[model samples]
Target: MAATIDELIALVEQNRDAVVGDLFPVREAAPRLIEASVYHPVICLILQGSKETTSHAGSVRLGRGDMLVVSHDTPVTARITGVPYLALILPIDLERVRTLEQSLTSADAGQAASVLQATVAGSAILETLARLLAIRPKTPEDSVLTPLLLTELHFHLLRSPAGAMLRRLVSPSSHESRIARVAALIRRDYARVHRLADLAREAGMGQSAFHHHFKAVTGTTPLQFQKDIRLSEALRLLEQGAVSVTEAGLSVGYESPAQFSRDFSRRFGRPPRRVLQGIAAE
Candidate 1:
């Protein structure tokens, strides 16, 4: 297993410009605090070092041989706790997973209450990823064989225990799927005001049931989730120096600048003005 991982790591390092569309290689040589960013559905495999990511769903640490599965769009703060971090991030295609799920038999029922799960990567998944990384981009193998390998990869994932999150996400009748849909909607139009009742109706649940399942899956309430999205976007705007603190606040749906400052400070541990100033100094 170690040899396979080492070879895969070398392949990623050698093929930095390879155009495998869904496979992204990450090699961070130094530990640093990665700012808040939205994490879409993906499987992240750590080939070397370790890191911790905290989102509304809580903090999780992953190291070598570990696989992290995220089933929704989560805004998170990530910190590299170990140097020479190397990983492969493969974005999941929901439509593909859904289509595959309908054909596979007795897929793991999955822990339907959580949006994030971490476990050791199975030998099958690791080897499949190695084959995927070995493909030369812009070649016939990449075009003809990439899709087949990805399907095989997804099949192995569906058959594994760690795949429970992916399984639950693709199950249209599952409560987690309903809440996931709502969460994706919130992320898309985060700048607009959303009513709890409207969100509940959209999820096909009563307000109380929707709220309960939402918090259970997301580790935060619906309104707080929206606020997380708003503040994350505000930080991006301030960091880019394209807007004033006040403008950033209003642009992301804050009615009052003071409230935005307070929320931004609470979320990121710095005032919006301070972020803007730091960007200007740079």
Candidate 2:
């Protein structure tokens, strides 16, 4: 008796995000195609085969025993590659991370390496999260087991090799860490104009280092990251009934509406007006 893909899907269905509960699962693959919308704080692990995520930051490659953790709300074009690309995904809540970060004290943490990428692999954590994903919703009988398991997961992370990689990941220090702070700022205020000089100064690093570290941390240039953020936010606004593409662009710091249209079209596969029109018709 082995776990099947249908069982995994049923387990996933039981732990809906609407219930604010995380899901754990082992998924089987279909050879034709598999893709998904960008998600938030996803811990994706390939237990058997492989998958690729196409993001503004570029493609993230994961394979057997390999994992990738995205700590933010990311926009990506993703597809599973190869046959039998079995995998596991765990959705973490932002508030949960915030709470864990507050409790952990690795005061001597260092700046990320010069080639730091947002993606990192932690086999130990992957094993635990993957096993959790294989299980579904629990009853009062297992209430004690759930918190105990989650607590162990949190502590084990602080003790793992992944924890060693984060000297300043949880705090602000050095060029790379500060620029990560700036990335957080952009996510919060993607609609505002951001000056490089201002960001560099705020990061407490030289402009050149700021640029270098920003690229290293995010795997994308600053302007490109901001542009992606702006466009993503604008689309969210449009879907919320912003009414005018020009208004959305202007709000997100695009002084030229036509330029906004071109960039937005390139990123989103269609111009704003037509995209919204299609959405409205839907």
Candidate 3:
């Protein structure tokens, strides 16, 4: 089991742009897990059994050979329902997304890539990804040899049955692509006072269309997304011991320090000050 876990870690390291490590080998039967929330995007790929994730909007389940992509910054509750269920989670940085986007766009596939991107994805893409992720690459790996794995994943998507859904992510002309761009802006400057009209303008869509398109892609309203970014940033700042509660709150676009405190407490189950103190006192 340890060897298998180690190998899987190595594979993820080779394929990942950036990731956070909190890995272990364990078996459990529903022992009250803590809520998980992150400031960036994470992909949870389940290898055995299943896990259910609940956001403010709705819940999603990822069974074996299935994955869930959390693209927004938000607080979420996760519960392990299936017995002895396990998953491999990888945090995908925006830099990685940009790299893939550029690679696909610059390729000379021309109309073939366009047709793939326009079609909705089916199960072929998921199956190929699942098989690749199941590998545990053990031994001295080439650091600069990652392009093949990345490109293979691209090709798999281009040819998969679910290729359309996967291709939706790459369509620079599609609504999904525009919303993705908006998401990138918010991620880069989460502290900005984001107005719906401003986001609509940036998305190059009308106000109503922007709202509809944004929610269609991210499954949340604009205000909810912003609030999530603020909270996630506040958590990271406190965790890193770089700022005081007041400073963290304001830096993440919180105007009223009191309101920030309240929201932080509500989302995190503790006030920012107390959480910082706990983290420091540890």
Candidate 4:
């Protein structure tokens, strides 16, 4: 296993551009904190060092061979724990998962419910990841090989121990799947006005049920989810030096600058101005 990961690390270093597009390599030579963001569904394979990730659901520490499978959109803060951290981040396509779900046999259909977002990766997953990293993208072979490998990877994930989480989120009738739909809407139209009643209807649940289930699945309320999304965007803009504090707030759907500032300070432990000042100093 160590030998395989060593080879993978070399491949990742060589193919740092990830021409395949969906496969992304993350490497950090020093420990650092990753700012909060709304994380979408993805699989993160930790190949070296460790990281501690905190979300509303709580925190989990992942080391080598740990696979973090996030099934829903979540607000997350992460710190790379060990030196020379290296990992692969594969963003899952729910559309493809849905298509794959249609092919599951009856024996494979009885996946148990799981609320966990992280798990120890199996040998099969590691081997598959190594194969994925071996592909050289943008070549004729890549054109034919990437798709097949991705399908194989996703299929392996669907049958892995964490498969339950993925299955529940993709199952059409599951509450988690319903809430995911509403969450997707919020993510897309975050800058627009939204009503809880409408969101509930969209999820096909009563207001109270929707509220409960939404929180259960996402670890945050719908309104708060929107707020997090708004603040995350504002932070990004501020970091880019693209907008002033007030403009950053307004651009992300905050009508009141003071409210935006307060929210930003509360979530990020600093005002938007600090981010601007830091960017300018750079």
Alpha-carbon runs more than 4 Å astray in model 1: 1-3, 110-113
Per-residue error (Å), model 2, residue 196: 1.6
Against the reference, the lDDT scores of all candidates come to 0.85, 0.61, 0.60, 0.82
Ranking by TM-score: 1, 4, 2, 3
Residue 176's lDDT within candidate 1 is 85
In model 4, the Cα lDDT at residue 51 comes to: 95
Number of the top candidate by lDDT?
1
User: Which residue pairs show backbone clashes in model 2?
Assistant: 24-133, 25-133, 109-167, 110-167
Better of 2 and 3 by TM-score: 2
- Model 4 ranges with Cα > 4 A deviation: 1-3, 102-116
Residue lDDT tens for model 1, 27-116: 888999977688888889998999998887778899998888888888888899997898889888888888787666676473443567
Write down the lDDT that model 2 would get.
0.61
Clashes of 2: 4
Q: Write the per-residue lDDT of candidate 3 for residues 1-282, one digit (tens) a residue.
A: 122433444555465533223222223456354353542455455555656677654676656555565554445666677765655654444344544665555343333211101122235444434345443444233233344444554564434432333345555677866877787688777799889999999989999999998776666888877787678778877888889999999998999999999998888788989877887788
Q: Give the C-alpha lDDT of model 4.
A: 0.82
Better of 3 and 4 by lDDT: 4
Candidate 3, TM-score vs. the true structure? 0.65
Ranked candidates, highest lDDT first: 1, 4, 2, 3
* Pick by lDDT: 1 or 2, better one: 1
